[model samples]
Target: MAQHGWVTQTQNPARTADAWWRDAVIYQIYPRSFADADGDGVGDLPGITSRLRHVADLGVDAVWLSPFYTSPMADAGYDVADYRDVDPLFGTLADADALIAEAGRLGLRVIVDLVPNHTSDEHVWFREALAAGPGSPERARYLFRDGRGPDGSEPPNNWRSVFGGPGWTRVTEPDGRPGQWYLHLFDVKQPDLDWTNPQVRAEFLDVLRFWLDRGVAGFRVDVAHGLVKAEGLPDWAGEHGLLDGTVAPMWDQDGVHEIYRTWRQVLDEYPGERVLVAESWAPTPERLADYVRPDEMHTAFNFDFLETHWIAADLRESITRSLAATAAVGAPTTWVLSNHDVVRHPTRLALPQVGRRPNGIKATDPQPDEALGLRRGRAATLLMLALPGSAYLYQGEELGLPEHTTLPDEARQDPTFFRHNGEVAGRDGCRVPLPWAADEPAMGFNKTGATWLPQPESYRRYAVDRQRGVPGSTLEMYRAALRLRKELRLGRGDLSWVDDASDETVSFVTETPGGSVAVVTNLGREPVKAPAGEVLLSSGELEDGQVPTDVTVWVRQ
Candidate 1:
């Protein structure tokens, strides 16, 4: 076995089949909020290494680590300054290597987040591009434009960045001359790279090779659809001048397929089984499937389930559309109910009676016991895993941890919230530290001190240490669901919709090569009659196999 970036060779070639991510459950770990090894109040690689056993105990096949590469922390590590080294704040390259090794030892494949769409303003490539002249080769590596607006006042095009404000940022030359402008879809400090540039494409391929050679099983490509843009820099139409004074058309750009095709070629060079899961926010299933074509990504996280309203019809329609879209492309699909960037489903879908208000407002009513929210979370989890696709579980989701947004204004560390005038509260609520114990402060996530983000107070009832062995706990439910999924061979199977007498219930049947399983879920709050079958698993407070209302049931027909 050779140690390089994050990969090591296996002694037995036969172990390749055990790579396991094809139908495997993946747990997403946001490093900055996972655990603190040296008590720096921030999660580091060594801290994650120490926590690998906890993840493994959840019965997941892999751990998807969010970005921990050398960065300015502007976007909490999405802005990479150095691709090859681990940030000093999160330990060194040696620490990453150790984490990878420990994960592999625990039989958990490690997948890392790859942000190729852009880089930090302080990155060496951006620095070199700035040093190069207007027509220099280095300058061609990024999207650089000349001049001000047509009226000599604003950006060249009526394009508003995703983070609010104009997408263009003015850059000055060393001679104090206003040189040109660059495009940043999110923040001015994070400049978008020119994927059309051959050199730029080749350089990123090298970065991928650097990690693959070391032993990383795969990547979760961030903003996978934003890699390409409309060529020739055309101006968008309309008085987009009203809101941030601009609007940019962003959808289904040409030449993106070419870039992905090239990436596929590079990934094929590795001998072991590796996967590439893309994060594409395209609303339409047809467009989202484009990222997972045979030669592109292995799977694209289908986020429609995350954004859809908590209703039977909508959830059923989204699932059917996702299955059909991926099946059409002969590409596998992946499902995610929650991630670092979204509101936790447990907190998001809890009924109004549970003190969760609609429209993102805090409820003034008394909060229900945490068990009620946990029940809803478990139901959603079952729904996600039962679907015919790979599934992703956010770090604290296994414990049914809800979101935490009680941080004081001074402690709000997310740059998006601050930079965007709080138009978006940002993703800090879902990125809180993992709670390892109920008795300890900070929930044992940090032994030396507090964490970068505040730990959720509700963790006292949902910590891993307290729930791992408890019957009917969220952790146990997740383990049971995953084990049942494997025993029934749900992932590598064909799905058929079951027509229920009631519209409030969504039921589907899965037929695998080994056997078949039927899953029925009642997405409504009202009591729904159970469809007749051999019930296997339920998300209700059942004793002696009697299911309660508002339950999810898996049965064998």
Candidate 2:
């Protein structure tokens, strides 16, 4: 690590005036859980448009909508059947057009999710492939191969699904007898596309142009790194330790870079500084940086920091490594804590800090320490906002919501839950609908008193109306921090270590055009002396002029 972080007097060329995504705060909206405008027990495009004011008021630069493409809903909307059209369940193509127009009116750009890795089993291409029988051109578009055993009874390889079953799903041939098996890294409904095929590449390039012409700024690429697999689909003998720095044949292949470079060329053709954000889970920061090289993606999520424990040494190391690595490639780092696919950070951080990260909590599992988690969560958010790069905020995180650990097992809808025989709860907990007001039907999410997933009783306390104007509330704190983050240009600033920080705290000073801003977070159990400066904002109240445990403070130098 550089002695004072990745400090540079030179500005990255990608930070040109219109390249907003480089230092922007993009909010991720899981369409199914954001707001139900139609009162049909599910969120839709109109619902999201209705809620755009709240998102804009939060000072976000853009909104990344999760997949709303026509789907069978087997893996939610991720199993996209049609990339060019909106799902009827999520409204229609007209509704999506209206959504983009309204968002632009509110000064927010839109980035839709693009699932290039796979298509729903019901997609026209897949259906045609099924009808074409073995060795047909349609079958060549996907990873279709003959089964290994007699009568094709076995899967071709030993690859297991990330959702907890065989990666290969056998399909009957056109002649009615059992035939070949196709690969699906996720659910059976989502068959992985063969990116090696030229037609597949051309289709995705067209998909990119289709949305760009409709006014979307860019895409939050779903399974960005998994699109290209290593040659010959090799078998893996090692455990898939997601964060253990293992490189699977199916992820982060070198061929992925060329694909992005092509997509980047399409983005440059547009008027606005279009962007591409990769959700790559590369084994190292250096490898993750490859996706965002000058001619590739604009940014990739920093999972190294997201998976770090709440220890100061580990966090500092992660941050240091991340900034150093990304800066080397002239790409701004993108930070995130909570998302639709994982346990909420507040709950995750409150648990025992020394173990494998929980996939999702269940009623039988040890629950989170709510108060402890919120404090730590708040501190972490403030720390993240003070960093010099772009950030992504998952919906409902601003309200400090935790995982619904007690969600009834019978109501779980994540395919992982079913695939795992209900042993793993999956991600339904964090993806629950947001609560906007107390005393309103479904907490202001809908009028029919229904939600796709049940919200907890505590949701009323975390409702947006309950915290909107209340001082020190999580919502207000976030608003204030965002306002200051932009006013002070913290996102475009340079970060340096605070030499006097103790071992239990991570402290840094950000230098911007206006002046210097100091940020300190006390991860220890006891309060510690804060860096000397005028207190600008804090994640919590100061205790005797000291930063308390699980708290962060921002000060002006």
Top candidate on TM-score is 2
What's the lDDT for residue 51 in model 2? 95
| lDDT tens digits, residue span 1-557, model 1 | 01112211111111122335546789999999888888879898998998889888777889999998999888899999998889999999888888889998999888998999899999998999898868888888888888665634467666767666788888887677877888887788889998888888888899899888778998989878778887767777642221121222443464677888888888888877788888877657877888887788787888776776667788888877777777777665688888887768887776453331332212233343455666777877887887666789999898888877455555666666766775556678788888888887678988765888766566788898898888888888888888888777677667767666567776777766547677767766556555456777788754344335457878776
What is the per-residue lDDT of model 2 for residues 234-265, given as tens digits with 9 covering 90 to 100? 88876553556788888888999999999999
Off by over 4 Å in 2: 1-18
Each model's number of backbone clashes?
Answer: 3, 0
Clashing pairs in 2: none
Model 2 scores a TM of: 0.97
lDDT of 1: 0.75
Q: What is the lDDT of residue 196 in candidate 2?
A: 88
Highest lDDT against the true fold, candidate: 2
User: In model 1, which range of ten residues has the least summed lDDT?
Assistant: 1-10
Q: What is the lDDT of residue 531 in candidate 2?
A: 67
